[model samples]
Target: MKKTITIPLGSQHISLLEPVRFNFSCENEKITDVDYNVGFVHRGIEKACTEKFEYKQVGYVVARVCGLCAITHTMAYTLGIEHILNIKTNKKIDYLRILMLELDRIHSHLLCLAHTAENSGFEGMFMKIMGDRELVMDIQEAISGNRVQFDFVCIGGVNRDISTECEKLAFTNLALLDKKVDDLIGKFTSNWSTALKYKNIGALSYDDAFNFNALGPLARAAGAAIDVRAESSILPYKEVGYKMILGQNGDIYDRNLVRLKEIKNSILMCQNILSGLTEGEILVKFKGKPNGESFTRLEAPRGEIFYYLNANGTNMLQRVRIKTPTFSQIPGMVEIFKGSDYADAPAILASFDPCMSCTAK
Candidate 1:
């Protein structure tokens, strides 16, 4: 019998962007069993949201759950509160919210692609993708007045409207970013390191994905048709040309391809949103505290993010619960680690784009 040894990937590792730990039981170089820990970075954000912050203030507070998807968190929390309050947002508000969300998706996906490239020893490609990601960040800053943590969403609607200059900046930068993404699609497909080597590494089967309850691109990459954007009507996703991009294999290559294709789709949706901007107020005035319980689901860059709120007709909430995609996909991620070479763990982990902060919160 081959000797079995255990190795730990992270709680703090060079290959990890988050504080997640993975223990791999390996026989020779093949991973035979896998265990993970995602609670290292927990900050008690949920506790604070329900106990300290009021209903209106919770939107900005929840935005701190994850820097990459700050807008997603805020939007989900805002929508949940709005649902309890019976607030009806107009067309322009919906469009603006979607615009910020797609832009957030573009930047987040590019960051994941960059991380995957770096973890796979392609530092040059990583740098290039990061540079291209700045275009999207610039557009977001122009619109939201912040780069990473955009507290742009509120209870009823958005905090700001797209101005003429911001619109011009969006059109110009998005046109350039679209061309760069096309080039990236070509490189990701043809490059030996990003494409061939990653083809069958760390693959998750469709059945495994379904059985494990995978969400977002992780599930879609495994041939599982799961996406909150397509399933939920919380936003006007269908009106803004939202398409669910899927891949046959759940390997690193397929995950990278799924993200690249989604970035292209998000860019198109952003353009469509800008071109079809409706005339209305971004933020609508409202009163009365939310008394009932409400929940919302949104498709974040990594996966589906869920928010549940229970209010007691007061300023503070009784309970605030968040079910992030990475939290749900941990089992699916561990399932993929088995039967793979130990050397590929970094690349595989990066492809999942696990957000520990969001999960822990």
Candidate 2:
């Protein structure tokens, strides 16, 4: 008897934890052609903001677009709103905004690390990484009253500010986290088997990536210098120092490395920001509504996030659109998975850190 087996992983897969499709042609150990079909469920978040909600309401709406990227989404929407209004908040508002965003990165990176660890069958490491990340999440909640959806930002400025005591608490926590991150990174990168497992095993070469027009870690993993944070700061980000991390191999390993290093650098930036905290107002009052079109670009944890809004001097926005990082990364994912082995596909796919909701929205 002869049997032909064709295993298609998705438009839905268990590892993905989201609705997305992968059509994999596997002949024994090798994957022949990998075709990805994303865009499974696109929630109409833009309409929810522009049509249903008021200008002020859009911040929280956008923030909730991706739970992992809540603050980043919130910031992107707020920055867009601010652009339309041409409003600027005070100094303390800037520091708090940057601080919350960086903390979100730490949390997001930690979750990625944990998930990657679990995917690689290192459950112990996963548990420990997740454990270490809990404090950061707690710190996030302590600062903003919610771990994932902080709702920290409003149109004019932030909703809360860190006091001297809060600063002292954060200082203690970040100092400890810095040391742990160094140790975890040392273990992740320095181990021979681990290094080899990532370094070139899931290699994503150049041509395949560009065709997809991928941005963020997915593109950066392919050796693209496409970081939005390097030279541009959307708000008062110029005052807060950030180093853009890049990888040349464009493999799972390089992405893991970039995320790890970026997390460490974000921790350092938090320390630097906390040391310079001064007394000021958390937010400003924007009594007048906005008019005309406005666009905003922010360096989110995933990559550059763009928001566009058209206002008509009304309570609600005339139009709104957000181009999330995940949307840009999908095409690149399809390209890299083309010829990889079936076993290696999951890790390869996860390296991009796709957020389907963000993409669909």
**Each model's total of backbone clashes:** 0, 6
Q: After superposition, how far is residue 56 of candidate 1 from its true place, in Å?
A: 1.1
Q: RMSD of each candidate? A: 1.1, 2.3
RMSD to the native, candidate 1?
Answer: 1.1
TM-score of each: 0.98, 0.93
Model 2 TM-score relative to the real fold: 0.93
Worst 10 residues of 1 by lDDT: 153-162
- lDDT per residue (tens digit) for residues 1-361 in model 1: 6589999988989998988888899999999999888899789998998888887888889899889999999989888889899899999999999999999999999999999889878999999999999999999999999888888988788888889999999999999999999999898899998888899988999999999999888889998999999999989999999888999988889899999999999999999999999788888889998899987899999898888899999999999999999989988888888898999989889999989999987
lDDT at 31, model 2:
71
lDDT of each residue in 177-265, candidate 2, tens digit only: 88898898787787653455777766666676667676766667677777766756665655677776767878877788878888888
Candidate 2 weakest lDDT stretch, 10 residues: 1-10
In model 2, the clashing pairs are: 10-21, 10-22, 11-20, 11-21, 11-22, 221-250
Q: What is the lDDT of residue 91 in candidate 2?
A: 79
